[model samples]
Target: MAHILLADDDKATRDLVKRALESDGHKVDLTQDGAEALDRLIAAPEGIDVLVSDVHMPGLDGIDLARRAIETSPRLKLLLMSGFAEELDRAQALKSPNLNVIIKPFTLEQIRSAVRTLIA
Candidate 1:
């Protein structure tokens, strides 16, 4: 019942995540990079409940995207995913009740559960 923006460079990951959230009845917007995701969020900051993004991308990475997203929409919840532990560390500065991180190779159930918890 929420609107979600998912950003990832990997097409397969994006599709999988989109399907996962969509099946849960969320309206999912797909973006190939953090820059695109930022643009979408900026263009329409309203109604986006959660942002599930990959921590590393081409132009704008998820960490920076999260920062900008919060500025654009402070109420937005964030789920930043990454395979690299270093990137996860970079997210430390963004620690908040609204922000969470998932290690890569996550299960669909885990992601769904995380999102549910985030938006709860």
Candidate 2:
């Protein structure tokens, strides 16, 4: 099982995603905002293996948050999810070569598969 840091502004979405990941035996540290996520990531870089975040959010946003996290921990895997296609594309264009992405309204299997593929 992996330790994942989940950063999303929506409380309901964050809760649901956290539960889904936990059900699959992954440990999830849920954060409601990007700044807090960055702080947590910096505080425990080795404790987090993957970061699953929503692209469009208040404060730091996912792209910046992911970039900062990567700077802090180069090995951290990033998986982005967003409802906005344009924003997602823009973020992807600037993302690290190995970063992964999933669109919003995805299935549990999709999330699980993405995580597995990265970890593998």
Candidate 1 clashing pairs, residues 3+ apart or interchain:
none
Those runs of model 1 whose alpha carbons end farther than 4 Å from true positions after fitting are: none
| TM-score of each prediction | 0.96, 0.94
* lDDT (0 to 1) per candidate: 0.92, 0.88
lDDT of 1 by residue, 36-68 (tens): 999999888996889999998988989999999
Query: Candidate 2 local accuracy as lDDT?
Result: 0.88
Model 1 residue 5 lDDT score: 94
RMSD (CA, Å), candidate 1 to true, equals 0.8
- The lDDT leader among the candidates is 1
Please provide, for model 2 over 1-120, each residue's C-alpha lDDT reduced to its tens digit, 9 standing for 90 to 100.
Answer: 999999999998898888888888999999988999999998999999999999889989998998888899998998988988987887788558558888988888888888888887
